[model samples]
Target: MTAPSPARVVAARVLERVVSEGAYADLALDGELDRRGLSARDVALATELVYGTLRWQRYLDWILAPHSRRRLDDLDLGPLVLLRMTAYQIAFLERVPAFAAVNDAVTLAGRARKPGVAGFVNAVLRSFSRRGATEREPRPPADLVEALALRCSFPTWLAARWMARYGASEAEALMRALNERPPLALRANTLRVTRDALAARLATEDDIATLPSRYAAEGLVANHGGSPSAWRAFADGAFAIQDEASMLVAQLLDVRPGDTVGDVCAAPGTKTTHLAQLLDNRGRILAFDPQPARLNLVREAAKRLGVTIVETLDGPAEALAPKFPALCDAVLVDAPCSSLGVLRRNPEVKWRRTLEDIVTNAERQHAIVTAAALMVKPGGRLVYATCSLEPEENEDVARRFLGAHPDFALDPPSEFPVALDADGFLRCRPHQHGTDGFTACRLVRCRR
Candidate 1:
């Protein structure tokens, strides 16, 4: 028997981790690829298969449901994942021939320890191949939410919520935008190199192209011949991978030189380092997070970017308000969120997050933002931001905070470089702005 293709095997293992163990897709795929030592082309193919299968799993399950005698969820994990990977290639990846996909799936199934599973896999894939193996358009459902969910491959509840918030046409656009592959956006480390200088350096190098970002002054969208991380510029800390929308958040904070800034929930430190750059490395930034390991990431980022003003603090972020009341000239609360806005990068999030999770996240965001508000001095600025399209975590939370705190007023939209809603909030959507969906509100505290 022919052995399973390396890409298919790697994809299946990564999918198993994502689906069965709830492991993050990016992390799982990276670990597997490192261990397997596949060629770059094979690694790319494996990545496409894993992300595409997960991104379209709901739709694939709908197609598989009619063919399988048993429910897709009830099938053994190995076979189910293999089926999804094969179906995704047949439907979406034009480079992969239908016969090859089926053959590889059967080969993989035969290797599985279960009896009769290989026969079942062959039968099912052959049945689809007989029908021309073309992706059939989903029939419209009676309910708008169901129709959107099925067509766009999102959870029904999330589709329903978007429909309610954005109306039908707009909601559909948002769903389509989220389904696209996100651009590789990089932020030029100003302390080390200017944006244009970095772009010029990359252009001079072999097989890399870059375009200036529309909104962010220090941002570039990279089109690479290979991994951007492997570039000499990256090793020299000329740029850090960050979405243009996230770079905008640091700019919105307006941290000036010699100011004292607080970054609550500052894990991974993309924005924290940006804040230091905005300060020209002159201001002191207290970057706080509950997880020490994540805090260490902030420290590492700061060091790599040549940012020296950031001080990492390990503790619950909320606890900092009492320890440093009215102590900062500016505070950034990039709260934990469902991250619906970043679905293009992390497709598994759509399947894992529930509507109830939104409410729970909103409660936590409100608490953290409240704590952050206390750290900002009178007449200082406080920016609340999230990578979520959900109003419960964005506008609703901001409104509730305003109702409770009379001293804090929404800052003018002019404070931010990006376009803003009439209510003075900066809301960037992927469909409209071509950036990750982000919402940020800048508030100023009045003298008590």
Candidate 2:
């Protein structure tokens, strides 16, 4: 058996790791990056090849289907992945000459598998290459891939659902925004240091550029030159990596010193620690997550931020709701939803998730919101938020909850970035904010 070329070897191993070990794309890329010891250019090529292929996988398969004599799925994962990479290079990347890209892939496949398999790959690629864009039929007025690429890059079902709720133009805009990469935003821990002070300290480090967040008071967007975590500020806990949109949720909560708060669905606690900063570490925070492993992460995050007020609990919000009985001055129910927003950060979500997830997540979100609502003291505030643009998870849930619990009324978010409807909930779409696809509703409990 012949050994694989460096490119083939890397792609083969990465595909194997992701499929067999269920590893994440970034982790797999990092692991391969270290093992291959690739130069900056090589690393860039590998990264683009891997990530772009994964992002447009469905469309790639659609294009590759006619090229293969056998079924596309019947092909081994390695060659199939390589074909997708080749297709992406041809269609999207102008710098990479199409012939070179296809040839490299064919050579890699041949060496990695067998000469016969190499011929198969080369034949299919050459055949597709000659026919060019002509082989691909004119995109219909509603080609799924074109619709997705232009309108939302979301699965057809998800896009249609968004169109129903947000109308055709907004839905298309929302989906297009999801396909674009999000800017790296971080929230400064005001309890530890000022944003300007942290930014000054970070400026000394080479390859890091800093800017203030347009929306959040203590937010900063960092330009990481190839290394995101290498910034000195990250290690000192002066800042926490969070979206500018997310930081607003904590801001709108308007936590004051000595105010008791409950953060349900708080894990990997971005908002939990942000609440701590707002309260000057003066109030008790009950941070609960359904999964214990995630709760452990919340504890670690709190400790890093030098926060002592947070107490972690592992249980359902419904079960714990009655125990807290109107104890919280503020409650943040950052309910889980179909994360149609922020797909740029996690491209796997585009393929892995389905329209069915919206219903399932909406049910879970409603339960959590209802349970968390119980903890809000009379005259206290409750903020229900999700990193989703879907109305079922945002407006539908908020409307239903307000109807069922007439004691709570929607309170307009003073600090939120997006426009609030007459109902007084903040609605954020990626196209509008250039931030994560987020929606948050702030409610205040009326005194009996």
Candidate 3:
């Protein structure tokens, strides 16, 4: 097999930034992919190496722990990163030769660290490469964290929380799915083109195929063919890269053409743009985010998709009620949470979030949804959603809001593909949805 290239080296550097400096993978990879001028294949390889390594880090540590003389945490972070990268390729990526993976890891380590560290990395990776090498047995279920640490490739506390919330089987399934590479999903800009038309354009590449979206008429499941951003249609902004579960949120809003809508916490405008597509660029959408930078992103996206109906506002979601009380036909509060569901895409979030963070975020979500509900006129719809699977931020917040606001009650709608309760709340998990770990619920304000 061919040896590792300069692109891999650049990927290692970016991965090191993610592991050490806590940089975002998407942002960091974008910079390096452009700086190194990597080909499409090389870009895909780098992304797989970096994201796969980060996703399965705990498992990598477990595999290497037997060979290390020092504590795994005490090992030099740079060389340890190389070990993790090598482990991911060896365990998961069958296309790459084992020797190449091990050698490249050692080479990358030598370039990044001292000779001693490189030697250590080489020895450990080669040691793991030997078949039938001794490893710690699969951890016992009695110790939930330890079991999950070994089984699911996640930090102990995170695994424990999931194990508690969703039993051992479901938690393991979710974690395994999250650790896998996410499929590319896109929402077609119906205002410009239909899903069938977009798929026909994408058909130029023999490897590309799309399925009808589970939720919306405009949604398409773009199978893994090549770099999605490099696709011609994407360049023209005919569609936007989004998760299947995320696309469902906009569909849940059930918005119509020429209706007034408000997207609270709408930065980078993933759902906001989808709402515009649903409205056919005829309705008013008041998009709000506290950060100017993200609002700029929303504006940029809107421009690319040819959406002119959205109006951007700079303020917290809670503050929007005062300016737009009883004005919107629908309100979408995509509140922030621990982001455990999308940890596969952003692995750093696993280590960054704590249980307290969940509670605090739930508090903020409740506030946002409560106030966001005020913006919806009586008998209008409001959708409260989050990427987080944690009930604290989903059902708990929704329940709290309903209890406080007697004017609002659960609304039943039968349009969803998944099973929703009588209250019309849809909760999807990676285990169930074949998508990210997300939970969304739709509510309606009762007529006064």
> How close is every model to the real structure, measured as TM-score?
0.96, 0.87, 0.94
Candidate 2: tens digits of C-alpha lDDT, residues 140-174:
44664356543233566766677776787777777
1 or 2: which has the higher TM-score? Answer: 1
List per-prediction Cα lDDT, in the order shown: 0.88, 0.78, 0.82
Model 1, span 66-161: residue lDDT tens: 677878888999999988889888878888899889999999998886899999988887876665544454356788788779878989988888
In the range 1-448, model 3's lDDT, one tens digit per residue, is 3456765787788888987888998899889887788877787788888887777777777777777777889877788777778777877777888888788877777776465887888888887877442443334467656877676778788778778877888788888888877767788888788899899888874457898777556778877776777788887888898888888888888999999999999999989999998898998999999999999999999999999999999989877677888999999989988888898678767767888999999988988887888799998999989989887888889998888889888775766767785656777677777777678888888897
Clash pairs, candidate 3, are none
Candidates' RMSD to native: 1.6, 3.2, 2.2
Instruction: For residue 216, give model 3's deviation from the true position in Å.
Output: 3.3
Q: Report the poorest 10 consecutive residues by lDDT, candidate 3.
A: 131-140
Candidate 1: minimum summed lDDT over ten consecutive residues — where? 130-139
Rank order by lDDT, top first? 1, 3, 2
Worst 10 residues of 2 by lDDT: 144-153
Off by over 4 Å in 3: 1-4, 113-115, 132-145, 205-207
Clashing pairs in 1: none
